[model samples]
Target: MARPLKDPTGAELARLNLNVQARFKAAAKAKAQTHGMTLTDYLEGLIAADISDLQAATGIQEALIPKSA
Candidate 1:
């Protein structure tokens, strides 16, 4: 069986902790009915929209700049 690698660095771990806390807070606020859907759903929707925008922008950029090589 393969063994696990070393733990994350302090800064990386702190960032992860902050992210988790932020999500938890968002979920709690969502539970209070501040937003329409749950935190998970809200994040998913936001991520999907972000990806769509990225794709559209990339396509426009490609059209404006011809591919070389």
Candidate 2:
């Protein structure tokens, strides 16, 4: 027999209201289902990726700026 999966601990819950076209919503749901992840997990992954990209861009921009003595 296999052990059961453990639930995540200390996770915070958030509520969001999005207004989108029906087709768009359906497409997103289908994509999430294909990846075998809940919609929440898929969205969280996207948000994390965006944050990382933004941080990298910011670091590059800061490095390009000249420093004054």
Candidate 3:
């Protein structure tokens, strides 16, 4: 039986504009492909993990979360 799709993270997203060297971009793309992940998924995983680490180190969870408008 198939289940209905749901919002994966249930959080709104904001655009991130990064400027990296061409080599770095290609390296990240290759790493994502090697791990069988789309570049977007791989980058999201990385950012989320980093944020979790930062939250743990700083003990300021609210600071990391986006401010509600």
Put down candidate 1 lDDT per residue, 1-40, tens digits, no spaces.
1111322122221112224677777666565344344444
Please give the RMSD to the true structure for each candidate, in Å.
14.6, 13.8, 10.6
lDDT of 2 by residue, 1-69 (tens): 111132133335456778989998888777766666555555654564567663354332232222220
**TM-score per model over all chains:** 0.32, 0.55, 0.56
Residues 25-69 of candidate 3 have per-residue lDDT tens digits of 999988776656556655755665677664464323422232221
Q: Which ten residues in a row have the lowest lDDT in candidate 1?
A: 1-10
Candidate 2 Cα misplacement greater than 4 A, ranges: 1-11, 53-69
TM-score leader: 3
lDDT of 1 at 5: 30
What's the C-alpha lDDT at position 51 in model 3?
Answer: 79
Question: For model 3, what is the C-alpha lDDT against the true structure?
Answer: 0.53
Q: Considering summed lDDT, which 10 consecutive residues are worst modelled in model 2?
A: 1-10
Better of 1 and 3 by TM-score: 3
Which residue pairs in candidate 3 collide? none
